[model samples]
Target: MKFDNDFFNTEVREGFEISSMMKRAWAAQMEVFQVVSDICNRNGIRYFADFGTLLGAVRHKGMIPWDDDIDISLMRDEYNELIRILPGELPYGFVVAGMYADCERLQNAAFVPQLRVIADEELWDFNDYMKYFHGFPYQRAGIDIFPLDYISKDKEFADMQKQIIKLGMEILGKWNELNREGSLDKFVSEFGQLCNVNIELREDTKNYIWKLIDKVSSLCYRDEADYVSSMALWIDNDSYKMRKKCFDDVIEMPFENFVVKAPKNYDEVLKAEFGDYMIPVKGTADHTYPFYGHMEQELIKQIRRVGFKGSVDEFCEEVASGRLRV
Candidate 1:
């Protein structure tokens, strides 16, 4: 998966240079994406470039110069199917993390229910790894998969479902906070009183809540509904809701060195998401640009301070086990 040095250092925008490190990270993300694409294609699963990734595909024919991550969206049923099959299908050193997988090493579920395809491998040095695979830090480089769930056509019911899902997420957050503070008993009591149910505290209370939210969010089947929204975003904003037909057919488009799938009517989809989307808007990103840059520096400092010679995966394990400070 080697790339030309000039390719890694090319400037996609004037005065907004894409560094070799960031480009290498993007290459790693694309590798993970290609793996998922292969699995999906072989199994008849469908997905589309989404959000900023979609924007980038349409505008730049690749990753945005400053964007550091990739996003893809799947219809709910396909999403569930992929989650069911992906774990056993990935190559060695690659695994699914985040909400569905509940990977403890990633611990990414507390924020969103989306999944991430992560590359978990050993690295002897931070700089060397960054120059190559660019996945030295555990969750540094991956593809974010968001599920698009059917939303009811009935306005009242849809609003109610959103509210219920939002409350469930809020409770899940409180549950995490209380658990972290060693106040699970208080959370259980308060949650039981709030819901008027005899809730039993369990190690998987959070998982249970997530399941409940998922059930509520997907009450409307895609075939029966006129629209779909990001299952992870509908709880907060309705703007993500779009006509189901927007994704009825997928068309292949150029993305970096690879061809990727996108919704056929991407113009309408992008217009709905970002009015006049053809015009470039810089610097307003969902995440920090160069996603793992600062963390890489800190990890390198800690490794040098301890004179650690082990692989990056081993270092992450030590940090997870409370034997090392990041």
Candidate 2:
């Protein structure tokens, strides 16, 4: 069906005024990308622009004007290398903020594996937390980095990995006995001793479990993919379908100036994941601030159209000082 009224169902596209904020954000994003790309190029880092970012580069030459995030991926070792090299090399107000697991908010699922440099603090605030998870810096608006692990493709590895998990679950039952209670740190510290118990009991459980951990760790790395971006804000099922329908056209697009790899099966992937990719689907957002002026513009076009009634000044004031104290 065409993108007429019936099929397009959703709230306004949201945060229309945020576009100004987004523009400032996009400029910052450009800065981060240039720096990161330079580092990667100089150090021979293997990187790729994946997911929405890739799609954006392919389609918009930069960030999809309406999207709020950016993602990039690197191979396992290269990811580690980036971690090792970034702390000392970053320009200013930016650094590889390290893994969020060690942070006080360990349980906040909103915190993704990689952090980005930004001035915002929250994850959903259109002006503040607009940027959820990204690579580098601890700022609110910035790019998120992802590490791709090479999962074992073989059946044996998969089987072993599963068995190892089973054995580990058994060990977890006794974790409290060794540690105070819910301390991942304690469990890991005592992991070696537990393995000995396995050998003394002639049980393959502990040994196998450790091996699995090692393998999974060595399976390269495991982190979010860079594709969690809003490359095409206008993508409805039909538009997404068009992507798959014309996979060959998914070529290099200008990403922060240069080009990066893009998905070849854009349409197919979206269709498979969301049935019809053209519908104005519900997106992840922070409801407190505001919403788009036209979420289902095409739909609203046919139905009752309510003009936006907000302003950027109402939500947040520009950083009048032109600088933030780190």
Candidate 3:
């Protein structure tokens, strides 16, 4: 996967280094793209550049100058194929996460049915900060792969679907807290306090939430809906619904001296999302967070103080149970 000579030479706004953090992030994102593309090609799956990735490929011929992450989307069937084969196909240190993934990394995190191709790496100084204070695992850098779920063309139903999934995610976050503490009673009491409703603590709540996610994501897939959405994004008065053709008929477009899949009718797709994607927007693009290859050491000391050398899930459990203080 040869990239253009200037592929890594993107300059960002003032106070940001182009050659250090930007270069590493670009290299990591491209590497992950190669892996994902290879697996898809080998296994007969379909995927395409999406969101800012699609905008960049069409408007700038590569990554947006200030953007450092990759975004792609896969239709329902192809998403299933990638999920089934990614575990064995990805090289060591990379993981395919989301609802279909069984990786330990997501075992205790909030559960959503979307997909993310993560490239795991060694701990950084910030890992200590995140682990102790935030209860977050060692952050990985990779592409955000969204699954295009079936959605209705009707505004009311589409909005309703978004609301349903949002509530499910809130419940999943509560479920993660329950898992972290290993205490249903603790979670139930907290949930009651938050919602002002009393209910018995039961394991079925988690199972039910999981099923609700499956059902909502499957709603459009089961029928021939006229629209589709990434379904992972939070709906704050924004609609992700795009015409079905934006996903069905794909065409390859130039991206950093290579070609990647994109919608055939990208004009309509882009217009629906961004009124004029061709024109450069005012000011520089904002930098995406959590890119790999940078860490601070003072943070590492804070993590080692915890004295726990187990999976991130276990460490979170300890923190939840008051055995370890962040």
In Å, residue 222's CA in model 1 sits off its true spot by 2.2
Question: Per-residue lDDT for 1-326 in model 3, tens only?
Answer: 45443543435633444543355456556767888898898888889888888988898888766566788888877776777788899877677655555644452232445677765544234334333222333356567777777776576876677766666566566666766778756645454443345556564455445545655665665366777666755354355568777776889998876778998888877776667788766434334244432453433554576676764445544553456665
lDDT of 3: 0.63
lDDT of 1 at 303: 74
Question: Which residue pairs come into collision in candidate 3?
Answer: none
Query: Of models 1 and 3, which has the larger lDDT?
Result: 1
Tens-place lDDT digits, model 2, residues 3-89: 122211222223323344444445456556667778877897766665556545655566544565667765557766876787666
Q: Per TM-score, what order, best first?
A: 1, 3, 2
Could you tell me which 10 consecutive residues in candidate 1 have the lowest summed lDDT? Answer: 122-131
| Two-way lDDT contest, 1 vs 2, winner | 1
Best by lDDT: 1
- Overall lDDT per candidate, in order of appearance: 0.73, 0.43, 0.63
Report the lDDT of model 2 for residue 202: 28
Candidate closer to the true structure by TM-score (higher is better), 2 or 3:
3
Instruction: Output the worst ten-in-a-row residue range by lDDT, candidate 3.
Output: 129-138
Which regions in candidate 3 have their CA more than 4 angstroms from the true location?
Answer: 2-17, 107-113, 122-139, 153-160, 172-211, 282-326
- Per-prediction TM-score, please? 0.80, 0.49, 0.67
